[model samples]
Target: MTRQLRTGFLLALQFFSVIPVKKQLPMEKEYITAMYAILPLLGLLFGSVLTSTVWLLRDTTEISSLLLGFIVVLIGLVLTGGLHMDGLADTGDAYFSYQDRDKRLAIMGDPRIGAFGAMALVVAIVGKIILVAESINEASLVWVLLIPVFSRIGLLALFSFTKSAKPDGVAAFFQKRVSHKKLQLVAIVALVISFMLLIWSATFLSAIVLIILLFGFSWLYRAWCLRNFSGVTGDLLGAYVEGVEILLWMSLLFFV
Candidate 1:
């Protein structure tokens, strides 16, 4: 059990981020399920890196908040290797194509980027930088740490509740291996932990509102994916992570 859990963490790190994991890990059912279960922890790791970066920049340098925000955003792109951003681009391209479901999926599978994809990437990146710049201050560093954590919690919820759009691909393969009950339990525990952190750093009311918004957006996004793609795909899941992070950051502008 310990070995599976450890390998699962490594697997999640390897597949989701730019972290180096040289040893090839087993991709068995238990390990893959464990990988999905550990996703929020992965988000926590990312949050820590981001929080640390903010601290280092603010404490050690005289950089402006706007530049600090841009650096933080750049670090995120570096950390994930823009994996989710690619998904966001693909999703934007496919959705705006105004094609049928099959055609949209085909566009997503293509390696080439379209004008819509480029536009989506620009808006998302610029929006994230501006929002982070506006939202972060000395009192609200906790919000920075919690934003990715909640966005990932949203990811788990979306994956648990939605069906894969196709019979093949990374999303479908992992979806088959996951135990929805176990994944839900993981998400619940992560949510509880996140709430505790939020309450410690901010108001209980704020915590409640953030969670509500997270899940509500996830529900709505699930419906949107269903309407457009018939179900979730790997690309759509990536799009959710990017979309939800932006939403969480934007929400902090209100409460934090």
Candidate 2:
């Protein structure tokens, strides 16, 4: 296969979802860099999968909204192999461990789960269900559809704007290759995506303001990651993604 098509944004889809793509052998950092260009689509694609299932459930089955929302969350977990969920857990354990930075980084590297990690996972999972269910009940399910997109927008921003904390972690490779120009392109991509998704929502004008606020909120977390962890890591990226997901849903609860 040609390099352009082979290494294209398909890498992002494969990286973040269960969906298969023709991955070129010996993956290149360039592929990853290129993938960041379309990160919003990754979220949009995932959200499409979610909303498709939701439509099926609502139209064909008699499932309770809360239960259906729970099921949707489960489908998401399966689709992403609980990718960000694991990050959320590890981040929780490491950050709340109260160890010095070095020790905390080491704790994050360990394979075993800590109490804080497990608690974080439980809270995130349950919280997502409640928020999504509320959206479903309000017939504002469109918000859920776009949340995966918004969460990814937040993730892409986090990845582009921050340095990596660990030299050898997965995030480090991309950090090294990402240029100032590339980051500028990525920010534009994210803004365009935000506008597209926001304008289509139920409350159009308020969505414009809300999305700007959301982006601002994500930037604050980027600062926090730098201050707390020294920079971003793969685990930290995942935690940010999950956090943005919840924040978007919660914000919608008030706005939608």
Best by TM-score: 1
Model 2 per-residue lDDT tens digits across residues 29-75:
56656677567777777888888888889768988979987998898
Q: Write the per-residue lDDT of candidate 1 for residues 121-167, one digit (tens) a residue.
A: 99999999998887766437788887878878888888888898888
Clashing pairs in model 1, backbone N/Cα/C closer than 3 A: none
- List candidate 1 stretches off by more than 4 Å: none
Superposition-based RMSD of candidate 2 using all C-alpha atoms, in angstroms: 2.3
List CA RMSD, all candidates: 1.1, 2.3
Q: Tell me the deviation in Å of residue 239 in model 1.
A: 0.8
Q: TM-score, each model?
A: 0.97, 0.90
